[model samples]
Target: MNYAHLKEELIEYSKTIGIDKLGITTADPFLSLKDRLIAQQENNFASGFEHSNIDERVDPRLSVQQARTIISIAVAYPSKLKNPPKSLPGKRRGFFSRSSWGVDYHDVLNERLKKLEAFLEARCGPEAMMRMVDTGALSDRAVAERAGVGWSAKNTFIITEEFGSYVFLGNLITTIPFPVDKPLEDLCGSCTKCIDACPTGAIVEPGVLNAQVCLSYQTQTKGFMADEFRSKIGNHLYGWDTCQLVCPYNKKIPQPAHKEMEPDPEKVKPLLLPLLSLSNKEFKREFGHMAGSWRGKKPIQRNAIIALAHYKDQTALPKLVELMHDDPRPVIRGTAAWAIGKIGDSKKEENELLIAKKREEDQEVLEEIDKGLTLLGFAVEK
Candidate 1:
């Protein structure tokens, strides 16, 4: 029953609701995507955060019974911060990626998706459609590509002509049969900027990502990050944007239209030192609304310690030493141990690490203490 007319009406409605782009496609299983997921798993490239059920991830029907069509929507977020806070010298700040700049896109996209779902439910009746954002079993990127929203680019982001890669994606699967749109042509020919610029070489090839090494993934992990990645992370406390920053398509991005997606400069880029002593409650009050806080304060705090070390901020050594000696969480203590050693080279700082090393009981913390001692040209007992 005239699903094409409904699609058109939904498209116009989406424009009014801050949806930057919308496209439609069939709900058939993503066969190639399943193969790619298997290969990614086999290669040990997946980050282990995705839904484990690969079948549900590739087949829309498994998620929405009688699924006949998929409508993908994109919401553009701010590319540039207005009057951003400085990450300078003693007042060094940690960065939250642009995607986390505003309110959590998951919430923003969910709001849009719910609205779209309501629009469809009215026309198609109740229980005929289902909505999902990033957490859903299906790959939003795959749906976007098949729906002509954008080209899946080398950095593994859907790069739309209108929003570049600075957009959020959400989709609806439905029983209604809508006219499908053709996929966009590949515009990223021989452009290896994202791959060449990846700090950990996480982009093994065009359109492929080794999530294990992606700084974005590394920052989200609630453990002592690998020593190799610690230095490469720079000031990133949440996610990394190096790949997108280097992509040519990302230049001159459209201004973010949704006010909810606009960032507060102070919040997104915050002073690093205070983050060290933040209680869970304080952290929640400050960052709970943002996307990056899902893993809670530990990962962010761990990354902040790494960022302080990345800057060699002597000012943070006190807090780092405090954590190394007193913080109950082993990951925090261990990461702080490493950062203290990595940042402080003086006799006083070396003595503090020596004291922490002697008293530290955790094997992981002891190892990090040893590394810190090694960094300061001190010998440790075997």
Candidate 2:
């Protein structure tokens, strides 16, 4: 079997199917990645969302028996919103990071991977290939870096020259011995833009991220947001982009041509108030298709409350009061209480918080109510 000729055919086929970039690499164990991941775990930098087994994450053979090569593909997503709606005083909106702007990349990229898998299976028999998008045990970035899809940048994103860091990466592990492509050179020399721009200083050092403090990771968390990050999150409801927005490599990149990745401004930057009252079914119907909806309504609603406080939108007070008094979830109720204080109309907000405090059963919610009263210049008993 002519592996070189097959690789050429795959590249051409990829172009026809909307894969923006493709590269191949031998499936040797990722020795360097294994060490870095161990360090990340030791330093408590891991987001805990990653696959826990280090061996499976770095070694392709463990994921796919007899894996000989990895084929990495990138799909570019748009950075700029087309005709974005204005976020005016009463009609404030919360931003979803660019990556969550359109249809979830997981679905879009997986469909492309399925097509590639079918093509490979037809040529090399049923047992030839296995494919993965971001969710799989194998590190998508590591595979992409080794396969020459892009260089892993200081912000920890795979930076493709054509798409900057705004590309979705995925891979196919195959038994076919395809010729390997060389990795890209490190291009982020002496650039501290991403590190400097990180709101929480989550980028602890060049090429290293303390995910626990990352606004993007924090936005996805289901629990009460730490107070330090509350103000820094601003109007971002799902994920944050300060690091990516400041990266020099991402500047002046052409808008992606892929229609699936184009941002629907209203969906990605929806009004914060409406989100607080969304029923579970309503949340699913409106946002389930977007990548940001993975953590469900609680975190988004909590962030939305924080965003309203960020705007200090007096219009949101009535709704915020209702959430503080009646919301079932303690995180939502507690966050709303904090927001009410932050967006203070001291007399009315303090009175409402005091009333809620008397009836609130959750200790965390009670603490937030007291904090709210205190923020409004009313003293609370210690």
Candidate 3:
């Protein structure tokens, strides 16, 4: 394989496939990623499926025979329509973080990588094999930084001067020996916009995040969650985007050019009442093709209930009452109770007090019921 021309062809092919940026790097830079794997698991900040063995993920021995090079690529999915609707009365809005508001990127990236790998084999002979995308546990952001695609920001996101941190990353690991590139230095000097803007304080310190406290993670989990986190989750249904919205780099970049990536008008501003009544089947049909559908209907519905509670929208009272009594998940039931308290009047409050009296075992739900009763001029039956 002629290394020089192979490198040039790879860059040209990536651009042809519509990738925003591409880079070549040696696999050796990932040696340090194994060291932090344990601490990440212990802190519970790592994704549930994140490989615990750092060596297994980054080691070429596990991924490919005689692996020598990695081809890193980035795809930008910037939002063309900005200004998410405000939290005002009678305004229906559902904010899916830019990442989740389109067809899943993983599938798109994998197809592109496979095509590139096939081209390599056709040119470089049959000795090369490819492991594409985020597989093999390689540190993609680290690789992209080293390859000169972008710099790693203090927000723990890769910030490209041209595309910002909105680019989706994927990689091709192969046995071909390509020339490696140098990494850029971190350029997020003293910028704390992301850290300070986090509503749940999930970004505890510079470049560190606790996924448990993140609204993104909370919307993907089931069961009763912390009350404190609930109040701050705001109107986000799938993920949080406050940090990216405040970033200067993102502001300077042009909006997405792809029309298919635009938020669906029907989905862009989902009504809370309709979302609350979604059966599992309906939810799967509606959002099954999207990324946020992985956790099913429960979390999305729960998030909508939280937004209603935060807004104190009385129009949602009937829906909240129905959910309070009928929701199979206790966490959803508890959240419904909280929303009802914020919206219901004295008569409806007394109805909820009776319901609470029948099943007061769940301390969380009972607490919400008590607050509702108090707000509606009811006395505690002490």
Identify the leading candidate in terms of lDDT: 2
The TM-score ranking, best first, is: 2, 1, 3
Expressed as tens digits, the lDDT of each residue in 252-359 for candidate 1 is 877976889889888899999998888999999999999989999999989888889989998888788888889999999988888877888789878988888778
Candidate-wise lDDT, in order: 0.90, 0.91, 0.74
Summarize candidate 2's per-residue lDDT along 280-342 as a digit string, tens digits. 999999999999999999999999999999999999999999888888899999999998898
Answer with 1 or 2, whichever has the higher lDDT.
2
By summed lDDT, the worst window of 10 consecutive residues in model 3 runs over: 79-88
With a 3 Å backbone cut-off (N, CA, C), the pairs that clash in candidate 3 are none
Q: What residue pairs are clashing in model 1?
A: none
Instruction: Work out how many backbone clashes candidate 1 has.
Output: 0
Write candidate 3's Cα lDDT for 67-127 as tens digits: 7887888888865556555545765556667777667777777777887888888888775
Return the number of clashes found in candidate 2: 0
Q: Which residue pairs of candidate 2 clash?
A: none
- Could you tell me how far off, in angstroms, the CA of residue 37 lies in candidate 2 after the best superposition? 0.9
